[model samples]
Target chain A: MALLSIADALKSAIAEEMRRDPLVFCLGEDVDIPGGMGGAFTVTKGLGEEFGYERVLNTPISEIMLAGVCVGSAMMGMRPVADLQYGDFLFCMMDQLVNQAAKMCYMSGGKVHVPMVMRAPCGASNRGAQHAQSLEGFFTHVPGLKVICPSTAYDAKGLMKQAIRDDNPVLVFEHKLLYGGKRKEKDAISTIGEVPEEDYTIEFGKAAVRREGKDITIVANLLMNYKALEAAQILEQEGISCEVIDPRTLVPFDYETVVNSLKKTGRLMIVHEDNYNCGWGAQLGSWIAENQIFLLDAPIVRVATYDTPIPFSPVLENYVIPSKERIVEEARKLMKV
Target chain B: MSKLPEKERMLGMYRQMYLIRKYEERIYYLFLEGIMPGTIHQSTGQEACAVGMLYDLRKDDYMASTHRPAGHDLAKGVTLTSMMCEMFGKEDGCCRGKGGAMHTGDMEVGALVANAIVGGNMPISAGVALAFKMMKKDNVIVCFFGDGATNEGAFHESLNAAAIWKLPVIYVCENNLYSATTSIALTCNKPNPAADRAIAYDIPAEVVDGNDVLKVNEAATRAIARARTGEGPTVIELKTYRHGGHSRNDACQYRPKEEEKAWFDRDPVKNFRSYLLSQKLVAEEELQTIEKSIESDVDQAVEYAQNAPFPQIESALTDVYWEGK
Candidate 1:
């Protein structure tokens, strides 16, 4: 085992996958230049020399074209690892991802399959509204697409491998704060985690329990997962035990794990960076309320961003997104109920 | 054109055009009778464009089509029965009834199920051709679209990629003059036709008389050959017209009656039939036999679709996620 950050784990996984399969390649704007960092987040830093330009392709600054190339190349049997410098740009290529890549298989009556991976660095990073929005909720609404958000180095490496091997279009949303290295953004806090040396993969639809407790169960994704852990630590000293569950993949959601945890704890709270209305957290909250309402001590609570575009100011953006204090206060209310 | 095809080849082309015309005519009447679910974007006046471009493509090769795909699907070898069943939203349809009239195709016969969104199939066809090129397979992909699709972002992006990478794809634009109600005169300002849109990407292009089967076949043959030789993609614009309206209920009020009559005067099946008879390749009696046989074949497809069952409710839950279980 070795101590690896999320960026290192992602870079190592791409390198290994490229070596293992010649069909696997990388494509994005600024992915490879003579002395440039591989993408805005350094997930592809040293890949150009190892794989060459053909494999580590550096494309023009066109998000729509980048996604179109991935869809076209993937349809032809090449496993293209496509990236958007920021998750906010995914809106530019919505037609390609939501229309083409997602529906190709079903439209062809199972005759065709797209084995492509799209990596987008998501979540608020004080880079203002344009670059800091959490866009996973928008993608989850599209059918025939798989959405995976990895919070740790271990999950990042394994899930990236799985996304590469899977015979469908998979979107891996990596949060900016959890990247865990010297990042391009000035305000990102470091939170490195340990990853194993041996090859391993974490399958989609499996939730990892970060802390075991009994008073209440809190479920979060990406940076929210780390925030939940911090809230659990503070709640422990106040005579309340909070159980934290991180669902790595959102599309093929692990409802059984959350249901079982809810049955034991009798209290639940859902958290995400997207807005409260129509957020993925709303889907989880509704599921728990519908399927396991009797087991809950009170109504399911969801902590999410206010329904507005991400703001430019650091103070306003933090207010829009859920904070550690908000989580603690929400957990206290659930304890009361 | 191409040294006047031998008598037998000319007769074969005539028969295929006849089949498409008869098949689409049958579908139009059936749709009017409320026997088929969903609306249709019929290709009544555009038979030659489909048959001519697809006749030379092998069964292993592929074609991606648009919302108006019945003609292309039939030309690419999808059977009339399955196509009819799909139109009726039956369980045995090409897409198992998940896709209806606007999207009808059978992939086993080298046709990707028709895409309903305008210009959505362009990039996909490029990908299919890219796959064949990467695998070192001599297969080619024919991407069919309307003149309106040329304005879509996908059209430019797919063409640039296909041209730069030398992908084995033939981009065939059936410029029926209108994308629904909007005319090509309003959409494009280029001198010749939609095929010239490809020149911007530095690929070979040509504008053909879409109603003439021989002319369309010659242009597609050249493009397909260029793709097979790994030279890159070609764009062929087939200047044709559709006799029927855009969809099930449309009466085509936007077009003038005289112009519609003029196109009907030059029906592709009739033109090909006259050409064959003039060359002494087929007599009136042989042509009648072919027509009768195609009529009966379409009758059998309607019968099959009428008797086929609807898909069960469970199918809605399947094929969403492939777990490999």
Candidate 2:
């Protein structure tokens, strides 16, 4: 086992995939340069040196072209791992991603396959409204595309490898705060984890039990997953045991695991960094309310960010985003219910 | 003027153009009779542009098309029966009725599914070229779009990327003058949009009389050769007119009567027939036989489509994600 950061884990996964299949390649703005950061956060650093410029391509600042090229290359049997500097930039290539890449297989009657992976670094880092936005909720709503958000180095590497091999378009939303690199954010947590050296892949739609308890089931992902764990630890000290579940993927959601957990705990509280209205947690809440209401001891609770653009000020940002205290408070409220 | 192709090649081009014209005419009549379902963006007057550009492409060479894709698909060798079945929304269609008129194509014939969004196929063609180049193959890709697509950001980005990477792609802009109801004069600032923009990317560009099949063929040959030799992408703007509306029920009142009459007078199919007879490239009897064969082929396609079955209702749930065989 090798201890790696999320950035290194993703880099290692991409390099390994490229070595395994000649059809695999990487492309995006500043992806490969002689001395520049390998992409914005060093996820692709030094990839060009090992694979040469052909495999690690650097493109102009054109998100539309980046997405369109990935779709085209994927259609022709090439597994392209395309990236955007920030997750919010995905809006610029909405036509290519939604209209072209997502619908190509269905539109072609299943004759064509877009076996591509798009990596977007998400989460709030005080970069203001445009740059800092956890946009997973937007992509999860799109059909024909699989969405995965990895919080640990182990899951990042495994899920990325799996996404590359899968014969569909997959979007990997990596949290900006979770990317443990030299240029750290102010509130970045230590997401370093031990990843196995051997080739392995984690299947989608499987939620991981971060902490085991019996009082309430708290489901979250990415940055919120860590916050949920922190809240669980705090609740444990107060004699209120809590179970934390990281769904990992939103589209192929692991409802079975969450429901099974709810069966044991008898209560549920979902947390996410996205907006409160129509957030991914809302979907889970509705699903449980419609089908799994018998298992729930109380009404479902969702703890999400305020429905407003991410602000630049640290105080305002903290006020809008979900914190461990908020998770704990929501869990206490659900327990009372 | 450039020299014409051999007699056999010239006749083949004429046959393809004639097939497109007849097939479109039959489809228009079928829609009028309420026999065909869905809508159509017909390529009535641009048969030569499709045939001349796509006639010489090998079966392995790729082509990406826009919404009005029947002419391009027919030229790229998608069967008439399959296209007709797709138009009828039947299970035997090329895309199994999933892709209607706006999304007709056959990957087996190296045609990517037609893109309905304006200028959506430009960057995709560049990526296709990138794949061929990365695989060390000499195959080229031809991307077809309208004059209005030139204004889209995707067009500029794709052209720049293709030029920088030296990808093997040919951008064919069939400037049918109008984008839906808006005129090119109102949308585009330059008279020759492709030519002016392609020069900024250091790629060669040209404008050809789209009604003249020979001229279009000659221009396509040069561009295809350049792409095959790894000379990067070339943009060709074919100045033509659409005989029908942008889609079904469009009367084209936005166009002036004189302009319509002038374009109709230079109708590509009629003028090509006259050229073939005048040059003695094909006799009247032989041309008549080819036309009759094409008409019969269209008739058979219509019959097949009318009798073909609709897809099972459960099929609607499938094909969203590729279940590997």
Say which candidate scores most in DockQ. 2
TM-scores of the models, in the given order? 0.95, 0.99
Docking class of 1: acceptable
lDDT of 1 by residue, B172-263 (tens): 99998888988878878974555677888998899999999989999988998899999999999888999988877788899988989988
Interface RMSD of each: 2.4, 0.6
Cα RMSD to native, each candidate? Answer: 2.2, 1.5
Docking class of 2: high
TM-score (C-alpha, index-matched) for candidate 2: 0.99
lDDT of 2 at A242: 90
Candidate 2 deviant stretches above 4 angstroms? B1-5
Residue B61 CA displacement from its true place in model 2, Å? 0.3
Report per-candidate DockQ: 0.43, 0.84
Q: Which ten residues in a row have the lowest lDDT in candidate 1 chain B?
A: B316-325
